[model samples]
Target chain A: MSRSARSFAVAGAVLLAFTGLASADAVKLGRPALPEEIKAWDIDVRPDGLGLPEGQGSVSQGEELFQNNCAACHGEFGEGVGRWPVLAGGQGTLTSERPEKTIGSFWPDTSTVFDYVHRAMPFGAAQTLQPDEVYAIVAYLLYLNDVVPDDYVLTKENFPTVALPNRPNFYDDDRETTEKAFWKATPCMKDCKPKVEITSHAAVLDVTPDAGKEGDKPAGAVE
Target chain B: MNQMKPGSRVDRRRFLTLAGLAGACAAVGVQPAAAEATPDPDIVNLPPWTQALGAGVNNHPYGVPSPFEKDVVRREVTWLTASSESSVSFTPLYALDGIITPNGLCFVRHHGGEAEIDPTRHRFMIHGLVDKPLVFTMEDIKRMPGRTNRVYFLECAANSGMEWRGAQLNGCQYTHGMIHNVVYTGVPLRAFLEAAGVKPKGKWVLAEGADASAMTRSIPLEKAMDDCLVAWAMNGEALRPEQGYPLRLVVPGWEGNMWIKWLRRIEVGDQPWGQREETSKYTDLLADGRSRRFTFIMDAKSVVTSPSPQAPLHARGPNVISGVAWSGRGTVTRVDVTLDGGKNWTTARIEGPALPRSMTRFYLDVDWNGEELLLQSRAMDDTGYVQPTKAELRAVRGVNSIYHNNGIQTWLVRSNGEAENVEVS
Candidate 1:
């Protein structure tokens, strides 16, 4: 037999061996998941109103809920308190030096707001809010962002209609194209520049936590 | 030349030699019996530890580092966030020597807090866009076939984020410590996905955690079936509580947030979920105000760990410069070290195994004459992607995009054998 034909025969044998091994190792282990179990855990919502529950809430009701449940951190008007996230406003500051990325200014989809609030909001207490309460809080947040009227009632039917100002600004990652020029195979080695100088010093900032002072209450300590 | 008996007397020649040495010391105006005249007490006298017995085996049912190593620990920068429960603690990279970070010293980043989970009661569900939705208990997962082990570095996309504008953190531990390399032991996610039989329409998978935050991220189905793992153990033992405990999704090479510790559910879907993390939080805001979404893969990056601010040079004669380099795309092929900023560069020797998407350690040995030095490292991966300088990165992505800052790092070593984090232009 020819050398090329012999090589092909060896490759075919390896493929056959792999196929046999795969079949022998296929010992399918898990049991079928109940529909109720899936419903309880699969709470993700897509941008096209895929997983919203049947519910409706008014901005006035959301005002009361936001004050009682979220005002301490998110603020009464979603301007934010302390270092907590600001949930509203910041309409056209995306181009600024320090952009305030609130729900209205930066979020691309209303489903994200509803999904995040339902899944992880209320800080320490999460996944406790009912669907109507989430709708109500979202309605009030929209009013705060000036995306809707104060009397507006958010419903499952109109949820997809509520568009965010920053929705059109988001695009898929393009670093491979936009930043391709920076990827150099043969970067300069020696004498790349005439001179080098210290432009900035971390010590001048003095923000680094003191290594000696790292005790029981270290920085970023959990409660 | 011969073994001595317990009660044997000293020979005349031995006694004479000792006496002569003592006489020489006395003639030199030094008291041979005085403590100060002993020259080196450590050699003359035995340490207490040599005379005492150590603790018995299993003294601690599980082992811990010695008390002398208490200073080597995970540290947190408290003011970085509003609450401690939803914060991060950095790994002590300056004190570590090799590629593997000890499980105890692995950095921890929690959205809500570390969840104390009972493994027996935990359940992982795979549903949505599958032929058969399945639920697997911890036992069921362990008994599955096709178990594999892989070593990879899990890095938060925001690692070195503070250094984007300039040199903000003082040490490599804070600036480059938000990453930990480990060997994960688990079955391939494909094993389970194949059992469930994904429908053709399934294009993405949403991984959800069991923590109070129920932290979630929508991952592409192509990635889910490619290299993802339903990992249960890291290093050799079960996962640490801070690291997800019973279970976690190992999204190799992607951002650490997408790993989803304490993972309880994966919902396959036809399109991306557009979750809050992907939409508002993790997305990179470019200089033009337009944001880049799904910027998952962490680019090639490196940093000099020794001769950094925290681990300063102690002596001036001979020094070994060591650091770690890694890439999300592939194995690091080359690492170049520069002692005079970017003006001169020399290839560093890479030590030990260099695995794909894993941390590779490199070292450069140099003789020092107490001159000021500016040190930097640049890494190149198998994909031909070279780590960029801070200036080069900023020229394209801007400093505002606080995530995926894999720019080359610089450490300035002074004549006094001290180092400081500085930006050299």
Candidate 2:
């Protein structure tokens, strides 16, 4: 018999055996999650300040925390160091050739800053920061971005009030309407263009890694 | 008939001369007039492997690729990121064939690096708006009903981000290697969600990783129930450590960032948790200063793998152009090939099975007369989406949108049998 036919036969046998027991609903295998377990892992914060913990932190405290924990990669003033993410100061360069998408300039929500810092910040050592420390770091980041005064004390009450400048510019994906012209059912198949000219060459840039020399040791070989 | 020893110096000299002549004849498609005078040494002489016994059945408990394929590997451009821990490596696409990318050779993208987790101690928790917040051990999940297997392609949104402005990467492996197709064995995410009993108000689900980054993304509950898989094995083996060994979320037909590796938690909520990846990084910024958010699906795209910069054409006459085409929305129904720029096009044969949301291999055989040619491929998916040119993509998205660059790639092949990545007008 063919492979499909054999698979069909096996499936029929299994179906016949499980006809009475099989149900579409849950089998209920795992145990109920305890309240403490739920609290420990459910750390995501929404834009409406839903998951923010009750805490207060000042810019001065944030400045110290930022320097100690984040300055190595994000820089002292959040300027970024060596391809690391710049957290501040790219206010109006989005339309330019090089748009520096910093948290202050391009980010859409402040909860994202607090949630990310609390959940995954400080790079190698994550989830080690206390709630107050995350709040302080977020405050310092706001100060660096000129969104708050140096003496501003950020609290869960005022977290929702601090909005990002770029929030209004973000919209849902509009590719279907915006790029409808390019979705030709029968695209040009003959003489689409009169002549073709070479505009750019990757050889001229010469940025590709030398695979021949690194064949023995693969690139990005983790330690 | 001086009875020369097989391993003697005279025998070696005679073997080399005859091998060189045989190679020359094969290159020009000619047969040696006096076949007996110069017997092919490769066939006449026995190599060491033929004379000696090979290793036993269990020589290597886990087999690896042959040493001759050492060049086939994942590669990274060091300058692209701050550290290797939070970086990406490209799959060697030029050296690969068929739809299924080998598990060892699949490209890896990590946020806080690979995590080595003891499966016995690992736990997956589902909480928030579920009727019964539940936590399951590895064994508990394995015992769940409705286990399934599926094939899908995971592609990074920033696969061709570097070429948004112009051709920057010389090889397809660097330019378009941030993708891999594999069969995943797991239980449908809906099965777990149903067991937990999702609350009526739960509109979205936040999937979080257990890695140091704890990478998180908010996925629509509709999509979660549609085809998502809480996958544990890939290509019929326990997942690689770099690929989230214990468990990972499989968000089919979506950007790879949503497929959280080292998956440990899922929190159902009414609203999207605007995390750092969704707000600041993955969002596409247009030339008009506005940005497009939640752009998840990767459009149809294809690339000529062989005859690329790394795998250059080595001989003249009949040559087979091989490539891969895929779509996040649906199956790649057709792929078209263009030789002399876009002046003319021909339909390439779609080889192998054309599964939905899976890579489709394509080939086009042609006779080359030693002339310069600009090669390109266009993919059309079941969703009626056609791969756009770079110029067309730029006119709408602009160069600032660093992600979702599914523009058609062009490779210029010269008369000398070498190829280079190039953009044409």
Candidate 2 structure quality by residue, lDDT tens digits, A1-223: 9999999999999989857654439475889999988888888889999999989899999999999999999999999897888889999999987788887889999999999999888898889999999999999999999899999999999999999888999999888899887567798887888999999987766777983333221111111
Worst 10-residue stretch by lDDT in candidate 1 chain B?
Answer: B1-10
Q: Just chain B of model 1: what TM-score?
A: 0.91
**Per-residue lDDT for B73-181 in model 2, tens only?**
9999887888999999999999999999999989999989899999998899988889998899999888777788999999999998889879888899999999999
Q: Using lDDT as the measure, which candidate wins?
A: 2
- RMSD versus native structure for model 1: 10.9
Q: Point to the candidate with the largest DockQ.
A: 2
Q: Which stretches of candidate 1 lie over 4 Å from their true place?
A: A1-25, A211-223, B1-38
Q: What is the interface RMSD of each candidate, in Å?
A: 3.5, 4.0
Model 1, B233-278: lDDT tens digits are: 9998999999998999999899999999999988899999998878
Report the number of clashing residue pairs per model. 2, 0
- C-alpha positional error of residue B91 in candidate 2 after TM-score superposition, expressed in Å: 0.6
The TM-score obtained by model 1 is 0.89
TM-score of 2: 0.91
lDDT of 2 at B271: 90
